[model samples]
Target: MSCAEESGRIMVGQEAPDFEADAFVKGGFKKIKLSDYRGKWVVLCFYPGDFTFV
Candidate 1:
């Protein structure tokens, strides 16, 4: 099985596919795309729904 099939996740050093999502920036929400920051470093943060309050 490939890395994706084995863990259902991208392995370290693997490239991430381009994606778009709503992001909060500068005290406002905006739509952003992964490709927009191409060639620059980016960090992604995830939180469990149960641990966060809407």
Candidate 2:
């Protein structure tokens, strides 16, 4: 089975399935997978503010 089911609803308190995405690391960007950090600490942050120059 895939991470998301047909209904596309993930129940609360459930473990987040594995997924891949592009990430900025070491002065560059690379493809990363959530599972790669298994058994380790990981921080996921979301910025709601707009990027503007003053």
Which model scores highest in lDDT?
Answer: 1
- What range of 10 consecutive residues in model 1 has the weakest lDDT sum? 1-10
lDDT of 1 by residue, 1-54 (tens): 112223346778887766777767999998887778988998877777655874
Best by TM-score: 1
Off by over 4 Å in 1: 1-9, 49-54
TM-scores for the candidates: 0.59, 0.55
Instruction: For model 2, give the 10-residue run with minimal summed lDDT.
Output: 1-10
Model 2 misplaced regions, further than 4 Å: 1-12, 49-54
lDDT (0 to 1) per candidate? 0.70, 0.67
lDDT per residue (tens digit) for residues 1-54 in model 2 = 223233455676766656777777899988887778989977765576558442
